[model samples]
Target: MSVVTGCASCGDERAAGAAFCESCGRTLATGTPPAAGADCPACGTTDAVGADGYCGHCGRLVVRPRDHAETAVATVAAAVTDRGLRHHRNEDAMWLAARDADVDAVVCDGVSASFDPDIASEVAVEAAGRVLASGVPADSPGGLAARVGAAIAVAGAAVAALASTGDPRRAASNPACTIVAACVRGREIGYGWVGDSRAYWIPDEGDAEQLTEDDSWAAHAIGLGIDPRAAAVDPRAHAITAWLGADAGPVEPHTATLRPEQPGLLVLCSDGLWNYLSDPVEFAATVRGAVRKESDLLRAARALTALANERGGADNITVVLVPIN
Candidate 1:
């Protein structure tokens, strides 16, 4: 007697003497077959799905866990990261944690031009977040600013270490990312940054403030007497002047300390969110309005992300919000 070796319905190889194909549960001696490898939602190619959760035939992503992620710590802090509409994968990463009345948050945006940008962002956020959560001693010199700078340095080292002689991709482009982190204790906030990712303080009643200065061409041009509007329109405007990677030399993260007199929100975000609403006043009003309408930090974060997507999501988005009371 001859043995059937394959499923006619799905084109999947059948096990020895199996009655049905495991892939699609099609009968080996089927009377009528449904369809061949119609499982791929993007492309109905027969048995052409890759192990990386992508349609091999059409090269469309199958939507993985990293596509969209969120976290919240009670009502104290919340964070959200999304792949956005145009990107195939999310390269932005964030970390948020609260200890009693203190809060620590970090947000990293991958340099899309570099290799394994996502990995760089993930490593940066984790390393910086751990340092922030560890907290500095009360008697420590330089106080919170010193600790925030140290965390940025640690994250920079972690990202640089990702490059090696073994992997060709790493050797060629090397993984790189931008980082912005903040630590809030009492009424004081200490923040540091290595690239264009930003930190902002939005007060409930008073004016809003952009905390970190971007290390980018547009900022440099504006500093050199060029009009802000003209600089922003330049093709090289968004090109980052500083980054974290093996190729980046002597990363001196910008650091600052803020003591706000009023209660509000401390926002750490990637360029994706700011690109849409860069104005401090408009940004603050939008965030405050979202918080008021949603009445929840997580939902407000989501609403902001949705707003970015609604306004042509050209890149990955990440936002972290810490309520300051």
Candidate 2:
């Protein structure tokens, strides 16, 4: 077992388990263990540990693992809202599920303006998860993107079927949403997306690089030499030219293989989260620091959302982060 050790003089990491750093000669602090009757391991908890090995908070079975790998947890958190200063209900949605040791992960962002945008987004995320678990083809150069596009097509058909139930809103309003998904099989990372919802590769203390671009007029303006900052902030930022839905054409996701040569972080978020980040450097720094702030990926993501809210919370917030260890 590794012991937590920090310098007494400057509160810096010394030798991991040493009483003092060999270089600085500063004393270190040890870690505190969980107290007896601590919260259960599963479901969730805050009350006393239960006698039934079930979480008193949620009554789900709890099991403390003996290995670190077995204990590694992946989670996701999101904050959805209508237009920052207007609108009644939030239509955006997102979820993080690390189904198998980070082998697969999915992040979905629903479009608030569409008919049943929320449902379309949720189904897409779940569908992506199912596709990855089924051993998606990763050998061919563009196979990953093709497979995702195919699966999204299937999900689109399902959405069409659901629409036929005759709720005019779901049937006629034209539901749609953007998505960015990542699947890690062994060390090969397959990612695919369409629309503005983004995927970022953050390796260590480096910058947060956007892996996808928005299919919006502002983006087109940016491409045409208009200042990105000024154009991105223009009031017409809500116009989206691409997304997934029943009427949306054959979904062809932007796909790529990512293998971080150096250990780092990955983030998948909607335009809502990125829109408020005024400075790219600060943006990357804030996201990178998130890794050190929380024990679980999900909590770190939630903290990121809170940071955005604290800054102004001008729009919906959604983020999913994955650490490559």
TM-score of each: 0.84, 0.67
Which tens-of-lDDT digit does each residue in 32-137 have in candidate 2? 2324466664544666555544566775644221000011233322222222222232344443334344444455556677787666765675565455545556
- lDDT (Cα atoms) of all candidates against the true structure: 0.81, 0.57
Clashing pairs in 2: none
Worst 10 residues of 2 by lDDT: 63-72
Q: Write the per-residue lDDT of candidate 1 for residues 237-266, one digit (tens) a residue.
A: 999999999889999999888888889899
Error of 2 at 49 (Å): 28
Using TM-score, give the best candidate's number: 1
Q: Which residue pairs show collisions in model 1?
A: none
Against the true structure, candidate 2 reaches a TM-score of 0.67
